[model samples]
Target: MWTTLITLAIGAFGAVAAFWLGIPAPFLTGPAFLVTLCGISGIRVAIPARLRDVIFLIIGTNMGTAVTPEAVATAGKWPLSLIILSLCILAIFLIGARLLQMWFGMDRMSALLTATPGHLSFVIGLTDDLKADISRVTLISSLRVLTLTLLVPFIAPLLTGEPLPRLAPATQPMALPALAAILILATALGLLFQRLRVPAALLLGGMAVSSLAHAFSITEGSVPQWLSLPAFATMGALIGTRFGGVSFRMLAQAMGASATLSSFAAIVSLAGAYAVSQLFGIPIVTVLIAFAPGGLETMMAMSVLLDANPAYVAAHHVFRLVFLTLVLPIVVSRNR
Candidate 1:
């Protein structure tokens, strides 16, 4: 118990430091501290099994509640637009990855997958399986996320000065019965998805089920803001943990190539987003989050902080995630 308390305190302090230093919000302190604790003790601290479940549940619930019927209606009208935009983004990444591979003489699969700009772990795992250069891939992927997280929040404001509207705060206290129903439903959905081997099942499936409930007017209560705080913190900490095992020697070797790939990817993504924004008549911030090469948690936090449409931002990024995952292997194989 005492160890847990100490861990929590350290995590909080790290988060506070990051925030003060103008690090992107959704500060990830928990994972950072866990990594630190592991380093200090020379033993891995087992994350309570329940904690992982809770994190995914929270993520799923938040995502599920985010989408409203209105958002769906808007998406329906421009069905082909989202598809076209996603394909364009995927193509850009593939081309950029190939260029980097040729320039740096890096492993083709690793460079291609690292430039995917979606889930880092998934990309890393796939690259490793393909016997690609894990070190270079990991470095470039991490740098891509970090660069995007830092750049978008600063650049977005310049492009879209007017803050987006926020979700109105809940006024009435949530009834216990409604909250209980939501939990039960979300849990069942998450379990089903897990059983079915769905990707990020807990998050994606839970959110889908919860959103369906919301749309059907089965649950009108909003997710308690308190629940989201830890979820975001956990996400941030996990991102920071990626740095724990990295060495200066490895980073030094990869730095030039990583920087070049990251910069090129960012520029192309931003330009694609700009063109899409004009074509679709959507807000620029939405385009930015959709095309921004970073973690989902970081993008969502920026969406909230910038007062942009969280649902739009979430949808856009999710769209990209799905797109990249599906198209990357096919593109790489064809080109090879």
Candidate 2:
């Protein structure tokens, strides 16, 4: 459709502009801001959800390449930080839900779903089945992502008191035979996870399979530039499309509350990041980006942009998503 083409053009412009201006994660921040402007203006633009899943598969495959044998060994020490991260996730969930309930007078189901940090689509999908406030849940979830995506780059440097590392674009290419084998394995695993009803199964499954192959010296190199770059661009477009039906008036009234709660979540994320950094000897900023409560793809893109460990960042986000998806539903169901 013409509208979709126009939307992509606007996103492309944003990406070029951001890169020209040297903003952090230009590909993501640019398209997200531009498409959000188009969406809020009532423009009819969209990206199919199925395409977004394909992008995630590519990103997951790319991230898995970072999992060398030593990285797998290091993961043995991740249990402590991961456990702390889980508790931090719980705190964020409870605090956010309570704030939404107390300040906005939202019911338990809506508040709990809206307060959850990730799995935006799955939570929104529950609205009709649970008779929750679809508008409030969508708005709050959208705001959380937009707020974090726009703010994290600025906040990250300040919190870590260090300059962001130089950009590192992966340029290596895997042979066609190796690439085909890796894709087949990853895709099969992704499909299997989907059958098991796992949240972000496509991403985590692909990542797990790819990581295993690489760790065992099966796959030789990274995902091709052709696949990875487009995946990143499409991911950016998806983030921007989130604002499609949101109104300025709705955001105006909820801005204060949402902003406060989002800030609290950010602070909590940073605290957890610091703890994990100290405990694991990783850079504070790296861990901070890893623990950032944004989309797994977006945060991993940030890690790639900031020259952080994308595998580590992806692992934390995947865990956060799975844990939230599993626990949030139960909590809401009990309260209801």
What is the Cα-based lDDT of residue 237 in candidate 1?
49
User: Cα lDDT of model 2 overall?
Assistant: 0.78
- lDDT (10s digit) by residue, model 1, range 46-132: 334466567667666665565668766667535555765676576657776787778888666666776776677667656644767
Specify the poorest-scoring 10-residue window by lDDT in model 1.
163-172
Worst 10 residues of 2 by lDDT: 163-172
Quote each prediction's TM-score.
Answer: 0.80, 0.91
lDDT of 2 by residue, 253-282 (tens): 667767867987898998898888887788
Whole-model Cα lDDT of every candidate shown, in order: 0.63, 0.78
Top of the candidates by lDDT: 2
lDDT of 1 at 177: 76
